[model samples]
Target chain A: MTAALGQSARSVLACGEVRTCLLPSFQALDGRAAAQLLRLRADEHVRVSERPTMYALSPEVLTGVDCRLPTSNGSKVRAVGTVIARAALTEGRLLQSTAYFSAPAAGPDTRRPWGQYLVRPGLVEPFGKLPQQATVEGVLRGAGRGELDLGTIAEGLLTQLRRHALLDRRVPFKSRPTHLRWVARRQPEGERASLTNFTVAEGGLRTMELRLPEDVPAAAAAGLCEDLALHDWLLTTVQQMLDNSRIGAADGPSVVEALHPVVVHLLHLWMPRAHVDAALGHLWDVLEEKPGFSRQWEKLSRRIRDRLALQAVTMPHQAFSPR
Target chain B: MLIFAASDKGGTGRSVTSANLAYHRALAGDDVCYLDFDFGSPTAVAVFDVADAREAAEDRGLHAYLIGEVSEPERIDVWAKTEHQVLRDPPPGCGRLVLMPGDVSGGEFATTDDNLRRCVDLLMKLYHEFDLVIVDLSAGRSYAVDMALEATAQPEMSELTARWLVFHRWTRQHVAAAASLVFGRRGIVAGGVHRGHDEEALRGAIRFVRAAVPDPESPLWSQVSPTQSAWMRKTDGDLKQLASTAGIGYSQVLGSVPLEPVLQWREQLITDEDVLDSQIANQETWTALSRLAARLTDDKYWEEA
Candidate 1:
């Protein structure tokens, strides 16, 4: 990012290009460490969104951890602590555990892929962190022209958290985040909440927090028990938002809005018999749907067009030739 | 549509017909995949004059896939060998010819039927991604032939619709082999002819190379008569009756291309003109052949024909 920006004030993070990355999350990895990993993706010139914020995940999976005041999901069975790609890049670490995968892993060959991967293995569970906390030790490695967008990363991690049922609260079917909690920790607030982050301060009012509630359903809770692609999608959507915002276009909210129901439909499409085949059919049907349900998607897509207009993006011409 | 081209014997015009038909289909703007499956000698690759396609075969050449090397099956390359051909270039949308060249270096067949089936599976995948798949099978029945036929018979084999075409000269022996290889019940050789050798010419090799050697006036033609004529009559009778039994008939038999040496030389790199004048105009021999190629793609023309 520093090299590509080359003293150009336009960007020192991303060199001003629209990059489509299918990022993976990790467990036992810190947010700073994940940021470090992001910086290593120097192949594409990325333009950082001005005043972007970090979004970290510490989604608490119901487990053996103790609470000062007894929590609502009961005393607990065993807490699954995890830190994935989003958590590692956002708040510096994750609070809970989930099956997180990483990218371009320089670690032991865990059969991880390099780019836009569907499944790339990383730490199995908690990178050893707690909620509302940042990791100073064992952290990720990445730095841009400025601080990374952890909020978008955190949002993306929410998808993994939701998919892996890493959250402490029960989610309803067809549930979408009606509101986002932007609590900034260690930093002052920015231009707008579109680049929202949980603002955690030492002795200040703006600190990151989660909304835990009583009367949350068991099936919704049980949904947290199963691994779902929708959860992955949720995090991916956030990453898309963060990436776009970094280049001065944040599409997080609308994509979240459009995809939430689609996610639900996708979840329900899975059946015991021919589960994969049936689910794909539903997915194709919805993906190929012309004149999409809402104009919000079109509005965002147009913004993507404008963003794409910002630069000369290229894939190796050799990649298209048959090997 | 997938055109599985095969012949009972070596001298049969299988490759010639296959190349011409593929040329026409490709010319019509259909993305075509031409796979040379003659694993033994791989005559189609040489005939298509794409034998040198080996230069581009580090990718998934047909041979490489058979040997478990490449993952992606590439298209046939229209090599520069056919520089002297009639057509300057093949048909238009006429992207690069993805020639899945044969295993020239190996000189061996697929290890097993399963491996040959894998080759067909790869071809079918190409068909799904492309508009047509043309498989040039070996001269005689081989595992490649069985897999190709089985692929066509099985509905779930591929998204590509299929038509089985048997190429043969208008000679008695060629026709006999063609009829028996596919007509009989057990697999394709239901009523098809068994292996037999042509008699040594006491006089000399017949020079009317374009025409069937057994001239009616020749005494060798007489010596060939009674049995072959009886067999031809029986083949006609059995095919008529067996069509009902096997639930398929001679109508499904696409057509036969003539044995024309001049036309056969540039068989693989079929020019638009080569097929236009010869593959279609040779009425006595290739009469039904051009019509067959025409119907393979255009469903409306098929309705009209």
Candidate 2:
């Protein structure tokens, strides 16, 4: 971490990838087990809070990557630095792993010592002048072969956590994992933070481009994106589940079978901006106006509940049958 | 449920047959994932008719994932990506069919602790997302087989159900080699036991699939002379006796595919169009594959004998 003055002195581009999936347990974990499950480093401590919700976040770990940056226009810019990764468990049900790094406007022509990179936890410096526009677009487009891949680093950390001995590797339901790639362009001081775009692509990939004012740390932007990613994943996953159910096209029992888990595990995870920083919380308003994430979520959750209610009214005995 | 397909020798149609089984499961409304673990020569892409995916996953395949070069292996949705006309449009209620191809140039390598862990992680992830996970291992007692054995024996996988399908051709040498690969001193049972699996449980979890078996009663052989037919019957009886004596009897056999020219030449999925419309593949071949796919998770079929 840089000094307080240095944090806002220069313009930095921050990018990250977050993977969200079910915790792979028959039941949601408690605070203690959640902490134990996310204890990635032996010497570090896992922060757990139960006030707002059962949340346990692991200490940040670093993965060193020295490779070429992915550019939209094929501008090859080499970078050398560490990528910080961390895991978080929300309400002991949904697990997320985020790997992110910030890059300054420019750096020395020659590579610095490894220790120098380690001290600056999540800062990746370009060899020469950094083309802010190309790098941000590249990250949103995804890295090419031999380029620095934030998704790979994030997935590696998630894989490590999913294989922890503390987990039983049993999931309550079947749902595909989702990846959200995000890039935040730092704005001048005193400017308002705004979300530029949120695009949902095929193959469970979602990209977010944002403009954040100075004084809000890159980590906070990462947090806002993570929150957005988690909720978007929930929406995407639940929608897919319903679509696969073939509600009117299929039988009532099958539709209920498909929508049952969303009611049990994910219905309560709709607290958007609950974990995002106060300053960045306003940025969600941009999305609230156009696509309306909360609006879509409320509608989806209502459909699930209404289906259950309708099933109960029609077939009471089969509605609550053991799953 | 996880199903691993292995063979003691190559050219036994192990990869093709397993890919067909995955296709059948998906047709039956079960999300199926076919993992190409044949590191020496990955060919599931050819069987699934997803040729473009092979080049796309050159460096991000299972090899890269297991060796820690990449985080998650590249997955190709077969229904959406297959070039074959019949497989392009999925039937209603048909589940997803995904193929995780191996590196185009990856060769067999020694299994390390990290590799085994990655294998277990991949299997677990697939088990949670898909209804059936079919991992086609490299033929013979290669590192793929070793890694599969070790990964399934881990404690995290204890509660999950896994079964092994050893594929072989219908021949004396192939039968003997397949049996020895499962029951011999250095076979799967022994290897699993050495790697902390229960011997009886491991033995019960394995079943054999005989490919390219020529049925003597078929109409195609009706033109043969009586003497030739009698000799073929005698030879088939002799092979069955040999199998029983070698400990891979009828009870251990899941199903056998009739020698069909389509499977031999195409090495692709036998869609219903091939049988009902095109009349290119034999009906018996389709029936055999359907039975094999059904028996994969049928507890009655896998019961200890």
Candidate 3:
């Protein structure tokens, strides 16, 4: 009986974190292909050359170069994006990147809503339900002192997005590109530096040529985009799983396991004061009758340490304690 | 593939270069994870400041995971912290480079030897979650070095597929010492250890390099680089000896990050000559570096039979 008590206690200790089945989040569904997708979401990297963005104002003062700041981590990464606007002396090249969604922006739909999307200019195709509003995420990567543009990766992304029916529109030609001004004298080989952003308009990719948001401290605000995406993806995934569970029967524990992070993120974003308590409370009750959920959660992560244990039961406001 | 950034010497830009390479690749749209396996220094925190990373034993870290102590993998706040360090305006969505920071607790560095095996398992798990894993070794090749090698080696211990050695040296003596250390009596001389190079091929194949503190004002910094031309081309014998001696490949010989004076004095971080220039200048160096990074990406090289 003593040994049995020890085993049970040890099991309880191991069962601190939640264990739910890894269910497919509906947010990733294209609503077309039902193929099981090994969804590998990618983060973009745009290295802004350390060179200053050059402004023309006409050819006289056009001698200066445009460059963004360094990373706060003391890295040499530069920002890259579509040139949203330009002011010879103000915003040299307003580079911006955007993402698109297919659902209505209501309580964060099943599809993860990236605050914005990399939509094609002038073309809002049917992407399920979310609106095709593209907003440039954070500067994913700063250009190293060594990287060069052999291939217009930006254009390639736009083109690929177009082929995938992901683009909103195209920009026009006669693209009078605004450029980064340079040092007084020009050097040879490898030192030839210049960069500019272009807008994806109805015609083709074109420079915004006006009303550009000046450098948004790319390095300082990096990863702002991915975190939001991750949050959205998780919540939408959780919501979808919850929706799906209403139809075909689903394993209680497994569904909760993959979705716990999503729900947690949602609580953190939408209702932080009670997210953990609420989640843990609901889970404790939901899982109390289902030993399988607790057992499986404990088994899968018997060795994992350092996370707050989920309270087995909900508590009144005064009773709900923080770990 | 696992790219081990090691140097017998300290402060050789191991962490910085590792971080930048991963950052650049992620910008190319590849998934990358940077592991601060430099448990000894644990500088990724001071350097990158992963806000969520505990510089102590308070929470889950590389330490707990290696000892089989962690219940779940630590969720580093890349977006809130180092992720911003990678991009200018924190790329709106997710980022390609993810960081697996080392334990901040200085005591964690005194890890037991066998723990490396567990660490490799953890790294492998992370690898499946990322396209590339960059390990910033503790200045010297500690147990972490052995773990990296074994992790990438063949089943029978013939060679490592995802293996590449970056030797950072400034002066001739440092360069020569780097070559010797990696090619000492019990060094890379253990021939046919891998399929790449032999002793004779490795003599001059040592990847001699200086830290990346560029003094744009200097003549070397101002001119067309990569055209800096080798001080002297290695003869076939010299090349063979270096390659064979070091047991590396010509391709695995990731070149150098030029010694920028700006880096020498400030040694803060790499940016442009000034913020004025655009179009990341100097093509050949980054290209060569990129090629080296690309090699570390192929899984066929590291997986055991």
Candidate 4:
């Protein structure tokens, strides 16, 4: 899906994948260090915003792919262009890297020069006619072997940032990474963006479908998905911690130890739409209606607080007797 | 924890034993990733019973990754992809088991600065994601070992814990070679120290594993004549003294694996089925592997002598 720059004749679909994980560092980085850690490109600027939360975003890096686009109908459209990868640090604790590109409806039958595609940044022009619906489904299903893999590109960037000399390579907690795959179909101009579907698949994979207005940039849609993925990861990680601890089955001290990291690093970072574009922020309402992300987060956070309080109240006697 | 499995020579069962350690760790609820850094002969796929790894490695394997040919290596989830009958059905609460195979045709290459950086990045990422990251290096003082030493000695990996295991067989030459591989000139200790690793700390992290040991008292050897049995026992005692003198003494040894027909012949993982249903592998070998696997993470076993 090509970002609508008014130069591209028509943009059909935009797709992206966001990989979220805990930064492997014993102590959270400050704003300067976060920016230093995320400086992917030397020339481009690394955006650092601290109004709502401490967030540092790296300049985008490009990966070239000349492979067949995955299509549900098995249509053969060999796209050749660059996929954009960028790293984002939220509160210096949670880190996310996104790889996204937009594909136009159609292009010349033959291949173009690599330099021609480099100018477009995050656009992969398809060969011949493109079936938008089938391509969207194909992307969500994931690329076949030897196809353009956005997840791998994003993960590669994440791995690169994680190996920076600035990092200590020590994680405060053991938490699994989460991946969110998102696709947005272009709507008519002046139409409000809307959410189509949100699926929580097994194995830490989440799928998001949206009807984006034609004017919205692909980067903004990526931002919305990254925001959703970060909070979703927080909720999933905390819930898993609770489940693994066996709160009711296990004793008090163990439960408190399990939930400690949640309070330290995750609790205050739950501001949804903090970085999402205003036009696409409404899409979050659809997710809030059913399996409410914020509601569950609050419930889990409160449970942790109550347990900590209870332990504080009973610690004097229990500490003396346990020894 | 990152465990580097190395050996002074080939045919030491280093790859199979290390793969088994990774498998055992995953079975015990610790997420594990085993990387096949054996660039010359990438045979880890056979050990895990992943049939299509040769093809997959051709597409995008660890070789492609380290050499900058591919951005990311293809990781095969052992449980989902393995053709092994028992590993197909993952037991409840078992953690993830992943294998990062090397390119089938990836011959040995000298280490460059970029290659070293890539190696560090791969190990650091795996270290963050998995509870145990077992990297099976090629035998002797190869480029793979040099790259591993340089990668772990980097500043980014300073906070991470890394250990080394040198595998050798039960023979005079093997014992002497294993000792020299660690303490001799141009050995792991020397190489790591040359690459910024603390000499004492690196020494503490290195341990020796004696593979293919034979117990004369076992029933398999009971059929021998009295003189043969006596000779076998005396030889074993002499080998112990030789090993101690070589500097890989009792304290430095992590564990020993008894010689089993399965490991020697098939060169495959000796699963529980081999002991119970198949009856192809000896129970003593299984128990020894289990004990070695347990001692891998047990602090008491790793304490510096």
Candidate 5:
């Protein structure tokens, strides 16, 4: 299928935005409820898996866009096509929705019929020659005014899922959501996919760049980015919890109370590359090597355990001792 | 949490005071998003000192987003975009302060089903992202107020917590007008109930904010003659009795902003520089606004009276 997509017209660039947040429910959803929440289409099926971790992936939905593509050089290039979006659930504890589109190098100058664009699920065709480098830089920076806004589309889907009646609308703790924007440029047919750069910016924004072979589908790229985003969110959120816990400044029970939610809802959600294709899973190596995602995670995990254990030892003495 | 700021009449300091409350909340490490829903005349851009946002939001603001003219409203990071020296360099550990300005040419328009849905969607999205979403509605019972009421009454928004802050100046006429705006026929309570809001729950969430209150005991008024001071005290007592009779008594009041020459002369956020360094704005005004910001989510202040 991916080969068929490549045969139609090799995509020069693939870019997407992923929004990761806590499912606004007090209790974590079971497998069945996860599927029901991620059912984006009435006719399509929501894939569910439980072996590695409880995860649900929704069918793709398309949004048509015809606007000026964001470019760094200020050159205006009109594009018109459908942007595909999908939602996923991890252990029913975290909810993520991604909006992405693939674009070829160039297309005819004139606009095409909406029906023609609808057939190709996630392909956006530029009206002229695509400025590959400029477009990649523009996407990494983010959409400007009157430019194609992937964040709105991604947020629209997230809002829809959060409003579903299945959710109880109760969050165990208050934490900010994270937005990860990723761009992948096409490499040669046989070259291995590589992760180029990853940047952590202010206000919970993360950007990543990748180079992938022509045979690997954009869907695989989206899956790989989603896995990376999920793990990044876990690390960011847990680190925040520990920082705000005020371990040395605040009292023992108070710090324990603050870290309670991390242990209950987030500590077990560190499985990386669980759903990415085998070809793209190696991208995780780049993150694991320098920053050592697992190493920092293990450190946080142990700190939380140590704090909880200290609380366990101090609870009885404090409760029964004379004041 | 969502907070709707409304006033029965203009010049009540509704917009400037609520903007200050938003500033105070953000300074205290809570991510806050302030929406300029005053569709007729948007002044938050000037208040927050984000002049660049004014030009960019002329065509794509909350009005454009609600009417479907744009995909998303323009957001100005107050810390990064503000021209004010103090606001430009936010203190460490401060949370994000975002402003969603209203369209320059936008005006009052009746709320339709589509507009209400979009409003709810925007609020829900902000709720999940920010800690506090402060929507500054146009004064009186306008379309903005109506839309906020109708949107919060929807089934999907039932689980979310929404509060109302009614601002009024401290005077006989202003107090009476503010009470009528919330309790009279076609008032917020009546209008909210007509649109499927539970009367008790809605009433529990409503609170009053008295702006520009004059205290006769303050040192600023020490030079006044004995006759004038006596008269001022008597009038203050009378207004208190009238407010209790009107059902917006002491318990119903959240906090009051003192009459500061700075806020009255130029409407802007009262930062620490304005209060301490420059000594232009009063310390009492700063304290009141901070207390009000903290009491916004305090259950003790919002409990049934």
Candidate 6:
């Protein structure tokens, strides 16, 4: 069923948006709670994995849209189909939701029955020939007014999960959410998938472009982007915390108090490619080589540890001093 | 934390004062979202001076989002979009200030199930992303207030903290009407209880802001004759006594904004530039707004009286 719906369409373009943030619960959820939180449908079973890391993924849900496709040029193309959205929790601390859809090169000019669209999830059928380049640019740039908006769908899912009864609705620390918008253009079946461009813009926006083989499903691309977005959010949040800590200006105990959340919740979450499929795991190599994500994370981890150690050594003297 | 700003009358300075509170909170390094829930008359766009967003939000504002016309409402970044020369450049280390304007053509409508659900979803989303969410409601007993009460009563929102501030001018009629609006029959407390809110808890969460109050000791009023001065002091004392009898005494009052000519002439934020450089707005007004903003989340001020 997955192959029939996700791969048999010979999709020419794939686009998605991933929103990542810390789960708003004071305590991290266990596997049972994580699975319950990500249960998007009653009848469908949520996929839970615990091999390399604890992770739970919700079953795919569909949002139907019959609106103008975002185009870089002034051309207006109305598309009618369903967009797929799913939620995933990593280590019960970070929650992510992705809304994505794939499109074929062209489709029938008339609309089909909603039942027909429901049968094939995550496929948005354009009325006519899909302007592959314009749509790609448009998705990266973001949807315009009255356009197909994947961010809204993803945010809606996130909001739904955060309101689950199991959650305590309290977070240890406050941090902003990050949004990663990505588009993948299909190459020949024999070509290898490669990351083309990644730009980090202001206001927690990140855009990624990729070229993937035709045999690879769009769901895999979404998975790869989700992984990237999750790590990016971790780095961004920790960096913000450190910047706000005022280490040199503030006293030692206060700085330690500020960085305690990172040490407790985020340091152990840096296992890259832990949940990604092996075929798409190579995409992390480019990011690993130039501006090493793990390297920066390790340095940050060391700084936090050294501060804690120093504070421990000086505890006796500080305790003896006058308040 | 969610703060709902409601007023009993139209000229109570509810929208402008709440917008300023939102501004002050953002300047104090808390990411704040100001929602224009005054569906009948959406004037926050003009107050924030975001002319560009005024056009974009005409069709895709909170009204459209609540009515299912749009999936998401348009959010205008006040610091980036405000045409005010002083607000254009925010101080470093300050947090974000976002304004979710109302539709230009939006009007008051009865609450529906779908609308209530959408309102809950929007509030939950904002609560997660923002450190403080200030919702400016329409005046008097309106659909906006009803929706707010219904949405907060939902089980999903029970875990979040929601507070209300009823604004009124410093007049005997205004004070009496404000108290009745919250404590009278079919008032907020009664309506909240009907919607499944605990009466004591809802009453505890509600506070009042007395706007446009004239102080007899201020220089602006010192030019009056001795008879006028005595009469002013006597009226102020009588009003205070009347407020106490009306059940909205000194303890229930959050803060009061002095009568400033600038706030009367123009409904805009009282920035330091206005007080220091331009010399158009009063320093006392700025200080009062700052203190009120700080007290919005202060536990000491919000405890049961």
| C-alpha TM-score for every candidate | 0.41, 0.93, 0.41, 0.88, 0.92, 0.93
Which has the better TM-score: candidate 2, or candidate 6?
2
Q: Which portions of model 1 miss their true places by more than 4 Å?
A: A1-323, B58-60, B77-88, B91-97, B107-117, B152-155, B158-160, B185-253, B266-290, B297-305
iRMS, candidate 2, in Å: value is: 2.1
Candidate 3 residue spans exceeding 4 A from truth: A1-323, B51-59, B83-88, B92-94, B107-114, B153-161, B188-252, B261-305
Q: Against the true structure, whose TM-score is highest?
A: 2
Alpha-carbon runs more than 4 Å astray in model 6 = A1-8, A42-44, A112-120, A245-256, A302-323
Pick by lDDT: 2 or 6, better one = 6
Best by lDDT: 5
The best candidate in terms of DockQ:
2
lDDT for B160 (candidate 2): 89
Tell me the tens digit of each residue's lDDT in model 1 across B188-281.
Answer: 5431212111112100110111123222333333666687866655764654465434323343433334444445554544353444665543
- Tell me the lDDT of model 5 at A13: 96
Off by over 4 Å in 4: A1-7, A39-47, A59-83, A108-121, A141-149, A200-204, A242-255, A295-323, B52-58, B276-280
Model 3 C-alpha lDDT per residue in residues A278-315, reported as the tens digit of each score: 21123233322443333433333331111112221222
Shift in Å, residue A90, candidate 3: 57
User: On residues B1-305, what C-alpha lDDT tens digit does candidate 5 reach at each position?
Assistant: 99999998999999999999999999887889999999999989989999875675467899999998777787888998899999999876677799999988899999999898889888877887688999999999999999999999999888789999999999989999999999989999999999999999999999999999998998999999999999999999999999889988899999999988888879999999999999999899999999999999999999999
Model 6, A1-323: lDDT tens digits are 55534443568999999999989898998899898999889999988888788999999998999998989996899998999999999999999999999998887788879997887789898888899899988888878778998998998898788778888777787788999999998899988899998889877899999998988888899999999999999888887776652553456566667677888999999888888777789999999986888888888788778777777677856622444
Error of model 4, residue A145, in angstroms: 7.1
**Model 2, docking class:** acceptable
- Which tens-of-lDDT digit does each residue in B188-273 have in candidate 6? 99999999999999999999999999989999988999999999999999999999999999999999999988777798877889
Note the DockQ of each predicted structure: 0.01, 0.46, 0.01, 0.31, 0.36, 0.32
How accurate locally is residue A300 in candidate 4, as Cα lDDT from 0 to 100?
Answer: 88
Stretches off by above 4 angstroms in model 2 are: A1-9, A41-45, A114-119, A245-258, A318-323
Q: Would candidate 3 be rated incorrect, acceptable, medium or high by CAPRI criteria? A: incorrect
lDDT of 1: 0.38
- lDDT: worst 10-residue window of model 2 chain A: A1-10
Pairs clashing in candidate 4?
Answer: A1-A102, A1-A103, A2-A102, A2-A103
RMSD of each: 21.6, 2.7, 27.7, 3.7, 3.1, 3.2
Badly placed stretches (over 4 Å) of model 5 are A1-8, A110-119, A245-249, A310-323, B53-58
